[model samples]
Structures are given as structure tokens and as C-alpha cells.
Target: MMASSNAIEGRHGDASPPKASINACLPCRKVKMKCVIATHAMECNRCVRKSLDCTFREHRRGRKPGTRLSHKSGSSISRKGRGDMSTAARSSPRRDRVSDFWADSEGLQPDSLLSHQAMRGKFSLQNILSTDHGGNIDGVATSRSVPPDDPILLGLINQQVAMGLFEYFMEKLNPYISQLDPLLHTFPYAREKSSFLFTTILSAASKYFRSELYPVLHDHAEKLYAECFRRGEKSTEIVQAIMILTYWKEPNDTRAWTSIGLAIRIGMDLGWHKLRKSARDHGGLPDPEWREIRNVERTFLVLFVYDRSLTLQTGKPWMIERNEFIESVESWGEESMANSNDHLLCSFVALRLLTGDAFDLLTPHRKSPLPRLNRLLTILQNRIEGWRKKWLGAVGPGNCHVFLVQFYGAHLQLQLFSLPLQDTNIPDMDGVGDIMPFWVSYQNSMAMLELVTKYFHFLYLAQDSVHVMTAYAAIFLIKILLSAPSTIVREIETPTIQAISDATKAFVSQCAPPGSSCTLQARFLEKALRDYSSPRNHQSRPLVYNETDNQCHGKDGQVSVPDSRVEGRESSILSGLDLCDQTQDVPDLLFGDDGSWADLFASTGFNIQEGVFFS
Candidate 1:
């Protein structure tokens, strides 16, 4: 398996020839042949013979990494790649502000924002800046009070304070997603590798913990981050730094997406995605080189998962093609098992893969009638159940926290297929039972609801509590309970909904200060749930509405199905994308890919049966 061919290209169109450089696609590169773009040339000669899509995309943006931005006085500097990053300062670093959501609280009721499409909840640079906690806070205020050239913010931290934050990052945050744990922990040794990466980690830590230093550290990170990429995008350290920065501040940090894009391109440049062949050819490469290569391969796999996670909801496009291999992930899993060091990362990868599958199986393009979709759902569910059993066995019983949070995430992404079905008002959807049992969908939904209920219980206990997936599950339950026809919602006893709702409210409040980006979205979702589950609405219906109705209902008893189902302003396009914290913003990536990641880690011992490949 190799990197996903169905990946999302960088901000520019598909092919970014490296700055002042020309390169061949992987196939041509492998053969050591020149890959030239002749007039009307799409595929390199080798790719055409192999019958593979000739997608030679890379992240070489308008200016290659390392090229300094040509700054203009008093104008917003157009940094290469997407340098769109920032956030407005609320009264307190932790307080919510109106500009964050780009609307006044007066006009925007939480219930309405959620019940109507959560357009404002979509991940955008605007949201990242408008809600960011950084300063000299120009990204948020857009005032340009400070020069973009300033990379150092005095008093950002001394060696002692820096260590405290680093400790916090290592202890509190690292355990949940530790792919780059080794690199992160050795920052003291690697700072010279890239100061931007070092500062970005601290900045992310400060933001994650909601330290007042978030603004200063973040500004320093933004300045140097641009510089790092400007120097060159191919340095493996740059990719690592981008991953760390993304994990530190995401969802609202759209700049992470740009960096993520660069990392993907750089991964391609180093041939990190398709390494098995490279390994065979580089016979003389030293053991240390192989180890480095393996790590690079793993990093690429993680990024591949991240891309799948994002596209699932935000409806963001992908760059990798469906035919790209995914063996890389498998290879890492196998290697990691020997040491037990990557047990958590394996779980993390597996959970996202399930979500990626769910996205592919359920996305509208399949035009898959309800019956076919149900069958796919069942098959995928069975696979997930297998993965869960294997994951628990691999992680062990003592590591209950890892097992539970990841499994909760699995339930959220897999069962999410039912939500779109529940909310979709497609007539003849009721006829779904003829092809397979209709109860299957409801059962799955109930399973998800139950997971949310389970998650609520574990929320207080799970260290490094992952909120985004939990939030997704919470909203899933709320949406079903709120809008689901009476019959289906009835199976969920009022007590269950009440408990879930109560738990959800507490969950939102818990995340408020030192908050996650999804807090407001959660609050809005909770409000919607409250409005729907209110005594008036519940009692207004005499008996459980029969599941016979194919239509998804609106506030009125009238059947109303939106044209696009649950596509817009709802979530990642591809679920527009998280792995760790950054990918969850695109966790849809962990959920779907063009098959490149599978190729990259193919020997990791996990593979979708050939018959199961969707699209």
C-alpha cells in the first residue's frame, strides 16, 4: 500500500512543480526516468502503462518553502501557502466572544444555529482567526498592530516556564496521541532543527491549557512557522513540527490545514508514502537510515489518516486517489507491536480507518440505495467490532483509558452513518427493510446513543479526554432524539435522552474555560436537544410515530427533506476533517483515504478484504 491518491491537493491546483525544480511522479521516480510534462501530457508514460491515475501533486506553493515573503509596507503580507491564521481577544483569554462566530448573540440563538445548518460551525481560517486567543492579537482583530516579521515575543517564556508548559504537554496531552511523542519529548535536543516547531509546541500547549501566554507564544509560532516552511517544506522535521502545531491548536486553526497540506507534499517528495519498494532498493542504506525512514513512513500514514478525517464532514475535497495503497499503516502496526510502544497509535489509526470507511460507504456519491447502504454498513460494523476486540487485546486491560476513548470514537464514526439516514427525507427510504432489516439502522443509532451514554460516564475518568468525537456522538444522540420520528425516538426511553442531555450540558460547561473549539457547537447542539426533548414537544405527540414514514421531519409534523441531506455546514465534507487533536478537526481522514496509507503500512496486518473495497 502507498499514500492515498485520493488526497486533497494543496491550496493551489493539483500539480505544484517544486520551485525552480522539476520532478517525476512516483512511478517515473522509481524507474529513475525523467517525468516531463509535454504538450497535452497528463500521465507520465510509466503511469499510463501501469493504468494508475497520474496524480503528480505536491505542495510547492506560489513560492517554495524557504523563500522569504516579499513584504509590502502597511499591507497584509501574502506569505507563501495559506498563512491565514489568527483570533480575536475576548475580555479574558478564555472567554467567548461575538466575533469568534461572526454573529451577534442577539440574533443567533444557540438552538437556531444548531437546528438550522451549523454554517458558523464550519472550520474556516476566518473561524480560526476570529476565535483565536493569540496576540499581539492582530490575527483575531485584523488590525496589523504588529509586524508579521517579528518572530520573537519577549516574555513569551523563560527556560523555567517553558519547561513547565512542556511538562504539561508531556503529562496531560501526550498520552492520548503519542505518534511524535519521542520527537516532542526530545525538543530540547531538536530545537535547532526548527525553532518554529519548538515554539509551536509550546504555543499549542499554552492554548490547550488556556495559559495567558497563548497569544505571545502563538504569535512567535506563526512568525517562525512561516519561516520554516519558507526555508523548505521537505525537511522531515518541518512535517513533524506541522503535526505538533496542528495537534496543539486545531479546528479553529485553519493554518494547520495549510501546513498539513505542505507536509503531504513533503512526504511525497521523500517518497515516504511508498517505502517498501524504496527499502528494497536502498540495500546499502544503514540501519539508522532505515529507522528514520520507518518513522517518516509512519508520519506520512498519520497525515494520510488526518486527511481522511477532515474530508468526511467539512465536505472538503481530497487529493489522494481511490487506488493509492495503504500498506504503510499496516507496516507500522506490525513493527510497533514488537515494542508495545505504539499500542495507542494503532488504536488511534484503527478508529479513524473505520470512520474513513463509514464516510465512503455513506457519502451521497455512492447513490447507494438504502438497502445496499445498509449491507455496507453491516459489513463495516462487523469489521469495526473485530478491530475493537483486537485493539482491546493489544492495548491490554490496565490501559482502560486508551481502549475506552478510542472505542468511543469508533462508535461515533461508524454509527454516524445512521444519523444522515435518520435526518434525510428521502421517500421510499422506508422501503429499506425489504433489502435488509430496517431495525438495523435504528439498532446502530441506538448503539451510538448508548456509546454517547457510555462516553458521558467515562468522560470524567478518561485522561486527555477527547472532546470532538465525544461531541459528535453527543450531537448524534441529540439530533436523533430531537428530530427522529416518534417510533424510533420512543425506543430510546425518555430517561436515556434526559440522561444524555444532562451529561451533554455538563460536558459543554466542562469545556468552556481552557475550552475546545467545539464548545459553542456543543452548546448549540445541546440547546437544540433541549428544545426538541422539552416536555411540550415530547407530549405533543400522543404515541411514538411509526417508523413507516420515509420522510425526515422538520419542526412541523410535515415531511421535509433538504436537497443535500446533511452535507452543508454540518461537518467535514470528507466530514471536512482529526487524528490526535489536529486530525479530529479532519478525523474524517482517519475515516477515509485513496488507499495510499494502506500501501504505506500494508504489512501492519490489517487490510480490507478485496470484496469490501467501497469506491
Candidate 2:
């Protein structure tokens, strides 16, 4: 019995301790801590120490044997397949070679085998902590403080090309945008300001330079923007870069409104909407402080301009409301002559504010009928004229930038007055008792064409707005030709229409680059003209005769008469009745129908007299 008891005791002592967990419990897995199970319990050491339940999750990591990488190049799994390969496997002589030429030369990490997906998703904690404060981890406050010779920062383009593009941007494009000052945004200043801004400068100038790096540079800019947006990064340079990209955007890009809206939001977040009162009060501030404050204000004004123009074009609501920030343009004190662009910018902002007023007056959202449209028209006209006179006098009419701004003012006034003519409800001036709107719109269309023809080369530089305005002018004229009453039609000679058409064609062909949105506008204008000039469309209209002599031929030698086929017995009955007294009232009769008079005339021409159109 003693031997048996001893044997039992030895067996109990020899039994192994409870096996520790091979897999981590859920809590341990989450925190990436090792799981140490108690000798005789299911709970892990970590869970027990924390007084929590320990549960294991069934998950198999890594890949199954003999499986190839995923076919999807964008998949994280595929990237891991390349990154997690054993060093021995990578050293095989027969394996595909990795391209690390740039990696070695640039002293970057050996990431040649990594996909763009990996690089985009890869973020260093240290780098984030550094850049989050708008500086490097090494204590640089801003990229501007970094040495301009940092090759990795300008890795996308050659150093020389970057310098050239920076110079070109300041010279050729900056005047139009007026965001960058040559004195402030020098080559070194731009190159070291921000990588995103540097890429944007190169991309904006690439088209004019005809550089082959446009596609690459433009793509890089987009990626950088996406990364910055994802990381919630904000800076003045980013705002300026966004504006540049929006101005010279990709063809058919739908992001213009959204992007400009984002820029405005970001700028507002940065407190760019308010002026620096402290800087304004203190005269002893450093030069850089004054420059920074000026840049902030300039950015806000430019953003306001972009927002207004884009909202008008897209028919979207205004992003920036009309506040004192935009309204204070006129009260600004005289700036030094060295920053003449400031005056031009201020004038441009004021003119756009006037445009904003015009937009507000005509907004479709208004529930009430337009109040005294004529009075409103006069007020807007005076404002636009005053603006033009002030700016033209300040900069002299010869300045190209000032001329462009003046042209925009003219375009706005044209749009305002022409609003009545475009209304479907009030088809003709007879309803409003205003022939001036019709004639003025016609004259503006003509003048706009002539002006564009004279200075298309200068205007083409601002292709964003110029192309749209030019197309609008040509199409508006075509609208008049096709539907205007005989009175106005007689005034528009054949030579004039032909001249405008030729100019439109030349502008589209010469100025519109391939793959430009202007090409689509040009095509639409061409189609409109083609459809109107077709003989079939004109043949459908009825013919009518001049009254008095009953046989007096009009200048065009085409008699006007109600179409018996369409009007049927109604025409015969009217002809049979005594219509001499009614002849004087024919103008009112032509517009008696609530439907469009242009539609009425196109379907059935009037035979009363030349007096109808004159009245």
C-alpha cells in the first residue's frame, strides 16, 4: 500500500503544469501584448492583472503555402506580399530585380518594390508630429527656413526647371491671380515654402512652358493635395496652391466649386477672413510680419473673387457672404506704389462685389417680383461705369491686367441688362414697355465681340474666364439674329454676323488648347448657329406683307404673312374682317399671347404693317 501511494504521489508530481495560451486573448491581441495563461485557469495574466475577461479570437495570420500574390496592384495584401518576402528569397539570382536606382541616388529608403498604395498609406509618427506644427522635427518652424538646396524637397522636377517655373509664374501668371508678390515670393521663397506649393507652381507654368513634365507634375500635385486633405493640413501656401489649381484646372473637372469652397472654408478656419488689426496698429512690426498680414488679406480677397465667379458659373450659392471684409475695398488706404498690384487687386475685388450685388438682385431664390428692374439696372450700370472709370484712370487703360478687370465689369453689366430679355415670362419689351433693354443688350453683344477681337491675345492669358465670356457674347448675338423682331434684325447687317462668327472660329481654333472645356463651349455655339441657319428651320415660318400700300416690300424683300396652314380658318376670318383700325394695335396683338412671342412669330408671321415692329 505504501509503494502504491508513493507511486501515485510521483505520478501527481510528474504531471505537467497547465499549458499557457498559444494565442493571445482578445485584450492582449488588441494591445499587442503576450498572453500568459494561469497554471490552472482560462484567464490570461494581462486580463487577470487588469481584472478583465480574457477571450481568444480565432484568426489565422499570414498566407497559405504555395499561394501567389493578389492580381490587384492596389491591394494592401499585394504590397505586403512584396514587403514581407524573406531576405533569402529576395537574394535569388533568378528573381525579378528591384529598381532602386533613384532610391540609392536620392538617399531615400529602399522602397523600390513598394507600390504607390503603400507609400500613400505609410505615415511616420515622427514626421506627422513635426509637420503638424508646420515645421520639421529638427526644430524648423516653416519650410521656408529650410535650405533651398534640399534635393529631396524638389524631387519631382529639376532644380533649374523649378527656378524657371517659379520665375515664369511670378511674371506671367501672378498678375492675373495677384496672390503672389514678386518681392515676397522669390524663387528661393517658393522652392522652400512648401512642397505642395512648389509642385503647383511647376504644374501651372508647365502648359505655357510646353514642358513634357506637365502630366507627371500635375498628377503629383493632385496626390499631394489628397494627402494634405486627408491629414487635415492647412496653410496659406496650400490655400494659394488650391486657387492656382482651380484657376487652371483640368479639362472637364467637376471639382472647381467644391475645391474653391474647401479653400474658403480652410481660409476662414485659419482666420484669414478677418484683417490683422494688431499689425495695422503697430508701425514697428517687422517687414515679414507686414508681408504675412498683407498676404493673408490678399488671399482672402482672391478667394472671395474665385468664390463669386465660380458660384455664378456653376449656379451654386455663394460660399462667402457679402460682409465688411469684401465691402471695405473702397476704404482701404493708399498702398505704396511698389505694390501697384495691390491697387489692381483692390479694384478687382470691388468690381466683383458689385457683381455680387447684381447677382443678389437677380437671384432666382427671390420670392417677390423684381422691384423696379429698370431702376436696379440703372444703379448697377452706374456702379459698373464708376468702377471702370476709377480703375481705368488709376492704371491707365493700356495696362493689360486693368483692361481685363474692366472687361469683366462690362460683362457683368451686360449680363444684368440682358436679364429682362432672357426671361421666358416677359417674352418681349411690349410687356415691360422697355425697348432700351433689347437695344442695349444688342449693342453690348456687338461691343463685346469687337473688344475681344482686338485684344484676344491679351485676354487669352486669362483663359478661364475669357473663353466663357467670349462664347457667351457670340452665342448671345446668334440668339438675337435668330429671334429678334424684324425692327432689330434689320439693324444687324449680314456682314456683322459674318464677322462675329469668323472671330469666334478664330478664337476657338487659335486660343483654345486641345482638351479644353472651351472646346465644348465652342462646339455648342457652332451647333446653335448651324441649327438656326438651316434652311429647313427658316422655311417653316409663315410669310407676311407690309400694310399701307399692301405691296410695299420690306428691306429684306421678304413679305410676312400668317401661315394659313397653321392658323387655318382663323387667318381667313381675320383677313375678311375690317382690320384697318386694328393695324395700329398690331404690336400689342403680336404679344397678346402669354406664350413666347419669338415662338409666336416663328410659327405665324404678322401681315399688319411695318408699324407693328416700330411701335
lDDT of 1 by residue, 1-615 (tens): 222222212112357524212334533432335454332334343333233323333322355333423433322211112221122222432222222222211123452222111122122345333333221210112232433332333555766777777676655555544545454246454444456656766776787564688888887777777776565434566677677766646334445446567778766654454433222232333444445555554566567666655554334765543223353344556653223435656565666665554665565555766566667667766776777677667774443344454445554444455534532432233554542323444344345444544545334323322443444444444444434455655566454444444444334433444244335334434343433433334244311221233222434554322112211233211121110111111011211233422431222111212101111
TM-score of each: 0.54, 0.61
Maximum-lDDT candidate = 2
lDDT of 2 at 387: 85
Q: Which stretches of candidate 2 lie over 4 Å from their true place?
A: 1-155, 276-282, 331-333, 363-371, 396-399, 425-433, 493-496, 505-513, 516-528, 535-615
lDDT of candidate model 2 versus the reference? 0.53
TM-score result, candidate 1: 0.54
The local distance difference test score of each candidate is 0.44, 0.53
Report residue 179 deviation for candidate 1 (angstroms).
2.5
Clashes of each: 101, 6
